[model samples]
Target: MRYGEATVTVVDPRSYMTYQPFLPEAAAGSISPRHVVVPLRRVLPKAEVLTGRVTTIDQDRKVATIAPLVGEAYELPFDYLVIAMGAVSRTFPIPGLAEQGIGMKGIEEAIGLRNHVLEQLDKADSTNDEEVRRKALTFVFVGGGFAGAETIGEVEDMARDAAKYYTNVSREDMRFILVDAADKILPEVGPKLGAYGKEHLESRGVEVYLSTSMDSCVDGHVVLKNGLEVDSSTIVWTAGVKPNPVLSRFGLPLGPRGHVDTQATLQVQGTDYIWAAGDNAQVPDVAARKAGVENAWCPPNAQHALRQARVLGDNVISGMRGFPQKEYAHANKGAVAGLGLHKGVAMIVMGKMKIKLKGRLAWYMHRSYHGFAMPTWNRKIRVFADWTLAVFLKREVVSLGAIETPREEFYEAAKPAPKVAQSAEAQLPPTRAKSEEKAKAS
Candidate 1:
């Protein structure tokens, strides 16, 4: 209510906004699935929330089309539009990827992955066939960024714990492979920390493949360009993300890379009424610009997105009234990545002094930063509680994979039996047909 006269509406496909940084913990069962998300309605009580996909935006008419989950499409008009729809996972034309590969983008995927990994263990333990067991034990991950590295790290940790309960399966039997075309992993933490992360995974028996590419994974047979082939039941793809494709549908000026073009003030270029931010907007790196660097753009990460959202919101309010809009400008504080429980890396920049940290201390730092940064007090308390409980309890490794297809058993049991042909007389009540025939004869 800063302006007191303006109304805001938030339209998104999901009712809640997912905090993606904790996806690895969720997948590893270190955190509850529900704790990683903030319900938009709960957080944005002043704004109107529309749970649906925005198919098209007609800026000329100031109306956009919304396709809801269980209703006909409708048009919504607005005086100003903010395109912060964010980005989606970028994938190439690799065969069988869409069919076989699991992603680590949302809460559902994290839960599904946890269940899937545990289910694979169950299968390996129960199976008698050597090939089946081998396939079930093999896990392949594409991409070595924060999503890929932390995911494999946390998941491997969880799997090792689960193996203690399995009779036939052990951590030795499970193969974890992380493949990336880049020469190093965790590039955000600089070279030293990235190499440390790689060595750490290697020490844990994870096969880290650098300067390699997956050729194809047709029918679960992963073929790499480096002449390595493996049959893995679990294939995770976390390569990277591109701007949301829906941006093209909106008649707005987009950058060469498909992000909506926006000025330093977070206002869409060439238009005063439109504003955009986050991954979908090509925001200028204000810190870089001040250092006399040319062609600098903000990196698409949680840190930037969170800050940009606040700045964008303020700019929107200022733009509505006749107030000067503040330009978004902030120097990089640092970067942090958690690798499973007590392992992590961090870089903190304070003026000219640069501090690098690794191992358990860095892990604690990572948790503290993100715990407070998590949107609402409700989520912060829940996340903190999960971390506090982890000190005394082990990670839960149970799988509910059946949740994906819950109605399968019901469908099988409730299936209609084969129809049998019955004579017309057999359809009649007992003796009714005979009485009717006798009456006809009389």
Candidate 2:
């Protein structure tokens, strides 16, 4: 019998889902936000996709406790389970981070942030107070990794282009600061490429502070550990991510970083009926093996996650019907990053040869790779069309800040009831008094 026929369900918390590689471009306005996200139901048509947070997993009974989006908690039973819940954004116990900073993780956050940035520019342009304008113009981004770096690059590029339309706001008056505890940015790429990316961003007037960390962002006045202080309205935090803590309740084997331990075949260790992949599993990377080393694991990235999912799907099917499973062995293809519109850095490994490219070539390579890697043809065409049209037409500068309250304007206009004119019969004054006066005159 098929797994779906024998009771199998996949639980994902968020409603807005996607492959996630196109997030940077979506934030940069290169691709529409709608094109970047794919519905979970469409992709996993066979499996039941439950929209809720998995609070607990009981491996002993092969059951998972899920809290539904609107209903009460319920138990789901399965013969075989796939744990691909993914990671959560990591945040420190900073004083005011929760109050002031925003994160880039899901599609909603990306779209909200894009609108928020443009709205800030509009607010700055209309305000006459210098203090308020400076605060509105200043943007602080914490973390120097891919999320932080790419996000800041795209937002800055869009903001710079947008400033031309604003009468008061100029690119020079606006401030963009990037803060990271590490000495370098984009460490996923090699050191040379990382250095190139930093220099490229700096040349574009982005103030990058290395070996520094954010101390506090209380009341929107950012304080850095490097003794630097800046008052800004916008703060983004994208330092890193930690595995979901709910896995610990499953009573299964877990690795040092709290990720589920899995074998090379993508099956969870000590369990034949369960499988895990993506950012939630620590599957041994046979390709990264050294001559003397016993086992090595691959890092979490879209490249690895996509391949791992395929292997996991096949292995699950094979196991359900009594067949031999295959081991996953794949080498890293290299890394590419877009700095802004026409600038990027890449390091590609083609067999034994390693090649590096920068500037416009790298930017084109980044777009081409991601364009083909996007989930479906429907999305790929939409993304390409958005970019193709962008070349000739100016970027859309309007911010629909009231997108959430789309009906508010109409509701306000319809609030008061219309006034009606009274008929002459209803308006006749004191008929009884007039009749009494006429009787006295008679």
Indicate which candidate wins on lDDT.
1
After superposing candidate 1, which stretches have Cα over 4 Å from the reference? 2-4, 420-442
For model 2, residues 235-320, the per-residue Cα lDDT tens digits are 99889887888889887789998999999998888889988898988988888774234667878888899999899889988998
Shift in Å, residue 291, candidate 2: 5.2
Candidate 2, which segments miss by more than 4 Å at Cα? 1-8, 291-295, 407-442
Give the Å shift of residue 269 in candidate 1. Answer: 0.8
TM-score for candidate 1, please give it.
0.94
If scored against the real structure, what TM-score would every candidate get? Answer: 0.94, 0.90
Q: What CA RMSD would candidate 1 show?
A: 3.0
Report RMSD (Å) for each prediction in the order shown: 3.0, 4.1
lDDT of each: 0.92, 0.86
